[model samples]
Target: MSEQNVIASLLDDLTQMQSLKTALCIGQDIAQYDLNKKIQWQYFNASDILNLPFTQRYDLGFVVFNDDLNRRSQLERGQIIVKLRDLWAKHVVVIAPQGDDAFMRSLGLTRIVDDALQDSQQTLWQFNILSYKNTPDWLNSKFWANPENWNKFRW
Candidate 1:
């Protein structure tokens, strides 16, 4: 193989390794959260979990907490929306719910796609706070970090 091909192969391997690590870390995080709740699996669909009343929303935030021994920080309920926005902006997750299709339609919200693994799907929605459809590089910039910009691009 040419030198360039060798370099490309190495890069691909590194990328896969990084993705594997991320998947592992995210999995561990979910396990820890579920353990805290005394549940085997704690992930729920975006639809079943969102559009909740204020009180219910707060409860949902608390339940997502990863209270594992390795988790020293408390769950940041206030920051959940911002995190979700980032996820949605990245197209890494959608906001589909698993129940009450008509309710979502009534509210004019698109149902979340349910084809992905439950845990994987939840991870995407858990981080999706904005309605933005495109994942732009500018999402990483500080200006776009503002919660106001979250509404700038709704799906």
Candidate 2:
């Protein structure tokens, strides 16, 4: 599915959730959408993900990994996902290109759907962070194995 369609579908699903009141979209600028008016929306980049303030938790978070050239290292990207999960009160939705499933899964994201075809021969993987606390111990070990991950979260 196209990025627009995926986003629309996600927004639609989120809107149906009575508990979802605020959402943050990271790594992608989707300010043009009308949905922004319906929900409290905030935008951020990968560089700012780590510094994001936790004063106000969001009901949902989205990270769009569309630009391959501007991507961060595998470990760094995984860190971003972890941080996003921490900021979200309920769930985090990630839109990533194909072949990154293993990396995302290692970071504790669950694949919500099979690969969907997109333009430019790209396939999109829709992964969700439902509950960080419920993640498998093995996956959590892989995520926390890097000291950098722990250092980043240290207050």
Candidate 3:
């Protein structure tokens, strides 16, 4: 790509990163205020800084998929969003990795960042903002909820 195209792509990617942060924030709030009644939290960090605990958590991470999960076709967009919101509302930290434009294109979304300039192979680009949700007491009441008794619908 020409230098101009590359620069433009990077800027576009940066913008997408901002959008992702906004989505996450909205997702987080929906979980706390709209969906899960028991959870509570506040926005604690910006997406760009990795020095803080927000950068430390590994259990939660997001990757923009190709939307090839045909098995998940029955699920509604609101359902997926609700699930994500619940997780964030529960204080689970997630990072939405920037994906390739081609991948994004396949999903009917455009790619923003270019990997060559950034010297990184991963598609996750941009530093947006980070939000937090309080952990629920029911889960912590046990090391792990027994699968036998757990309801698959809620889990």
How accurate locally, in lDDT, is each candidate? 0.31, 0.66, 0.32
Model 1: per-residue lDDT, tens digit, 64-135? 223331142213322233333323122122233233245334333344343333543231232222443467
TM-score leader? 2
Candidate whose lDDT is highest: 2
Ranking by lDDT: 2, 3, 1
**Model 3, global lDDT:** 0.32
Question: For candidate 3, what's the RMSD?
Answer: 17.5
Over 4 Å off, model 1: 1-75, 78-111, 116-155
Alpha carbon deviation, residue 155, candidate 1 (Å): 32
Better structure of 2 and 3 per lDDT: 2
Residue 53 in model 3: lDDT: 30
The local distance difference test score of model 1 is 0.31
Candidate 3 deviant stretches above 4 angstroms: 1-22, 25-102, 115-117, 124-155
| Decreasing TM-score order of the candidates | 2, 3, 1
